[model samples]
Target chain A: MNIAVLGAGNIAWHLSKALIHAGHPVKQIWNRTSEKAVALALEIGADSISTLNQIDTDIDLIIIAVSDEAIESVAKDLQLLPHQLLVHTSGSTALDVLLTYTQKAGVIYPLQTFSKAVQVDFSQIPIGIEAFDEGSTQALFNLAKTLSTKTYYINSQQRLVLHAAAVFACNFTNHFYSIAQELIQQSGLDFNLIRPLIQETAAKVQQVLPQEAQTGPAKRNDQLTIQKHLDLLKTNPAWKLLYEQISQDIVKMYSKDTSSLK
Target chain B: MNIAVLGAGNIAWHLSKALIHAGHPVKQIWNRTSEKAVALALEIGADSISTLNQIDTDIDLIIIAVSDEAIESVAKDLQLLPHQLLVHTSGSTALDVLLTYTQKAGVIYPLQTFSKAVQVDFSQIPIGIEAFDEGSTQALFNLAKTLSTKTYYINSQQRLVLHAAAVFACNFTNHFYSIAQELIQQSGLDFNLIRPLIQETAAKVQQVLPQEAQTGPAKRNDQLTIQKHLDLLKTNPAWKLLYEQISQDIVKMYSKDTSSLK
Candidate 1:
């Protein structure tokens, strides 16, 4: 299927490249800045369109892989082909927002955080897709299948929930690393020392349920160590708040189980 | 070298199994509980000793792979040869703590989290070692080198600092997952949806530094989305605190560069 990408951000740049590599023709590429669109198109040997009005209605799909706030406006500007499927690559935005403009509207969200500097292996990334009509849904499903082994026909509600989970799993988790880096720097240790532990912790969850895999002061209910960590974080409000919130949640999780065992 | 293991916890169990697999001579294994000691020894096909008095002082090393609080007590109980190396597999405890009891003292900390159910590949894990004397240090380093491809000559101060970082990287990061799991549960989404995101976030760090590879609303400083996420966590005070703290940190980190550019 020929695909037209409607943005020039990280997700768009990576996804367009992956599609081209997977033997799909990118019909057209467009960005608010025409140069970005031209650069990406030239790299992938696809046509570049400077304006949404220039987007061909004959294309199979128009993927608006822009920021959450930018998607609605882009959709409003694009004159959709009578039967062309329109989609966005946002995790938080609802599908109904696209449905209002086109009967052949859907979502083609790739469930991985992407960056242009680091190439993503789309074959391993899960793709969440939804469409208002069966024909459009099947097209999106097949398109996802070509690029990945896992594809889900998730609805708008589930997509938003998945998006929220993505925030915790990816965004919030990165914040934890940043905080860890900050704390380790303050403690006068090389960040390299914790690299193995970080890699192993993430690797462990592949084989174990996260709840069963938890190990630490909070998991052990060791209030002494918890207090020590909190004391260490006192000077930095970010670390202090994070330490408290996670500790409290851990306490609540364990307390529920502790009472049941009694 | 004849080795004696003085604990039956996660680290002790895994390290002992690796030693036995590598054809090292484990003289005996001891634990507070006779059953745990017997079980561990049997698992590695070594003898189990219920009393520290029964340990062979002629052994080359006696590793106190116990909890931080129990290390001193265990070290006090062990009677060893004058030249025998005494070490503890702890990141927080100082080597001096063991040096006070034995002339030959050192540390042999494997920088990975271990679980009894999972068989860890020691060859891939990094081992941190330190000793009081050059001879003892070389001996421990040789022993560590035999078990793992990666080894570090880390001092007491470095070990403690590394341990604190491990808490932030592994312990606190897992708490982030717990928070995500809770959010997904509330939103009525399958917790598994976030697994790919979690895995990719960690995998990306291997290719680039954390500072250079950060993303999300917080990193981008997109106030609109940050406001949305904070609002989502408003009901959960603990999560709210964490959200605000991390957001502030992100703001502070980016503000520096943003201001410089202005």
Candidate 2:
């Protein structure tokens, strides 16, 4: 498909490069700041567009890769035709956000974090495709399949749920790591000591359920060790709250009387 | 050094095997339950003893890798000479526990989790060593260096802190995985979609600090998306409490007002 990309952000840089490498024509790139677009277009052999009106009308697809709050505005400003399929690469935004601009609306949300300098293995990242119509959906699946081995048909609600789940799995999990780093640092220990343990904790869940992969004082309900940890965190109110809440929940989950959980 | 193991649990199973593989002579194993001791001893080519008196007095080191509460009793039961070294593989227990029984006390606690079915690379696991005296500490350093590339002279207080840190890094982090798994499954989505994201989250921390690697609504303080996620967890009181506490902490840590955090 002949594609034009809007915004030169992290997602745009990685996704556009992946698409072009997968033998698609990513012919034009546009951004509010044209220098970013120009720089990226230069690297990928595509033309840079300062104005949305400069996007090729003959392009089969135009992707708005801007932030969620900017999606509707970018969609409104884009110059489109009746035939061009329009999509946004946002997990939270609905395809209907683009309906005001065109009837040919779709979503191709990659369920992974992207940073400009990081080299992403696109084949390992899962793509969640949703569209207002069947043709547009099929177009996204085809576009997505070129770069990834996994693609699923997910609606807007499920996409939102997945986004929330990602926040817990990726964002919240990293925060726990940050807490661990803080605790270790306060004790004058190198953060490097816990790195292998962090890696193995994640690796363990890949082979088994997270509940079954669980190990620790809370999992075993060792109140003695729990109290020792609590005493250590007595001065840090924030960490104390988190440790207590998380440990209590873990104990409740693993305890025989799990009647409240389900 | 000729070593005798006093327990046949997770730590004993992995550490003794690593010691044997490193060509250290692990001569005898004894546990309260003789069957467990026999099973582990057979696997590691060591003698299993039902009575502590049956242990080889010629052994240079004795490792008490039992439960933290049991460490005191086990130390009392072991028969050791003035020249022999005795250590407990517990992060929370102190060298003082052994001081009651022997003057040659030390600790060699591995800062990693072990399961019966999995094969752990001892070279990657960090060992935290503490001893009552210089001679015992030197013996532990030499013994630990044979199996692991990383070893630290961590005193009892520091070892306690490290143990709490590991709970956050490994056990609490896995519980976060469990929470993510629950959220995804509750939405009728497959948990597999987030595995790659979880792996990358951990992998990013290995290269950079966790604070620098943090990404998500809380990190950026995106209130709109945060509200949406909170709405989703409104029915789950346990999850709701955790979400609110953790997100609030992340926001406070990242927000411009540097009032609360150190």
Candidate 3:
């Protein structure tokens, strides 16, 4: 299948490479910055376009792999035939945003973090697909299958929740590591000491439920150790509050007392 | 060197197994429950003692791998010769706690979560050692070197900070996964969809700093997406509050202006 990628960012770079490697021909690549677009196009053997209007109407699929805010504007600027499918690769953006510009619209959101430096294994990364109609859905699903082994037909509402959950699981978790790094650095200790613990925690969740895998002073309701940690964080009021709040939440979860409503 | 394990808990099981595997002789295994002690002792070809008085004075090293609250009592109960070294496998406990029980006291705290069900490779596990004197410190260091490749001479204050950091990086991070799992389960979406995302997020930290690796609506400061997620979380006040707090913290971190304090 012939496809046109509409971005020059990390996601676009990785997605275009994966699609090309999967035997799909990328016909055109467009970005607001022509340098990045030209570089990506040359790498993927695709035509470099400076504007959305330069995209050919003959392409079978047009994947708008731009930022969430740019999806609608990019869709409005595109000049495509009604038969050509247009989809935005965003987890938060609603499908209706694409329908405003084209009748044949869909979403093929890859539910994983992408980095230009990192080579992602698309085979395990989940691709969530949603389309305006049954035929377009099948086409997007078929295309997604070529790039990933795990594909799901997710609606807009479910995708929103998935994105939120990803924020907590991925984004928030990374922030926790940052906090850990700060704590160790302040104590004049190497942050690399905690690397194995971080990896092991993630690995444990793969086989066991996170609830069951939970351990530490909070889970054990050891107030003494908790108080010690809180006192240690006295210099940083923000961190102290965060530690107190999360510890309270964990204590509540394990206490089996739902008197205090969540 | 002759070693006696003072508990049959998860840490004791793993530590004893690793010590034995490293060619160090486990002279005895003792626990309040004789059955568990016997099971672990038989597995590692060591004597199982039901009472603390049964501990042989001939042992070179005594490792008290009990709960934080029981460490002092276990140390008080141990009957060791003057030259024999004593240690507790605790991160938060100070080196002085062990010195109260024996002149030759040290610590061999492993900075990783352990489980009886999961087998761990000690090569990557960081062993934090602290002792009352230089000679005991060297002796404990030699013992730790046998079980782990990563050994550090961390003082009591540093170990306290390290333990606190582990809570943020491992324990609190796992709680975030629990929150994500809860959210996805409520939405009737497979939690497995986010598993790859979780793994990738952890993997990113191995190469890049967590501060630089952070991504999501929070990091992007996309208030619209944040508000939408907040609206979806209205029914669950506990989660809603958590979501708001963490998102606010992330936004504060990325926003150059320090006017907004969380």
DockQ of each: 0.57, 0.76, 0.76
Q: Per-prediction TM-score, chain A only?
A: 0.97, 0.94, 0.96
Off by over 4 Å in 3: A257-262, B257-262
In model 2, the runs with Cα more than 4 Å from the true position are A257-262, B257-262
Evaluate candidate 2 and give its CAPRI docking class based on DockQ: medium
TM-score of each candidate's B chain against the true B chain: 0.97, 0.96, 0.95
lDDT of all predictions: 0.81, 0.88, 0.89
Q: Assess candidate 1 and give its lDDT.
A: 0.81
lDDT of 1 by residue, B1-262 (tens): 8999999999999999889888899879999988999999998888999898888866888889887778999889877778678899987778888877887999999988888987778898888899999999999989988999988888887776666667777877777777777777776766666677788888777666677667887777777766766666778776777777777777778778689989
Candidate 2 per-residue lDDT over residues B147-200, each given as its tens digit: 899999898999999999999888888888888898888888899889999898
Question: What are the candidates' C-alpha RMSDs?
Answer: 2.3, 2.5, 2.9
lDDT of 1 at B250: 73
Clashes within 3 Å, all models in order = 0, 0, 2
**TM-score of every candidate relative to the true structure:** 0.93, 0.95, 0.96
Cα lDDT, model 1, residue B150: 86
- Residue A187 C-alpha lDDT in model 2: 92
Tens digit of per-residue lDDT, candidate 2, span A47-131: 9989888888789999899877788888888778889999998887777788887889999899887777567899999999999
lDDT of 1 by residue, A1-262 (tens): 6689999889999899889988998989999998999999898998999988988766878899888888899999978778688999887778888877898999898988888888778888888889888998888898899899988778876676666556777776776676677666776656666666777778777766677788876777877657756666678776676677777787788778789999
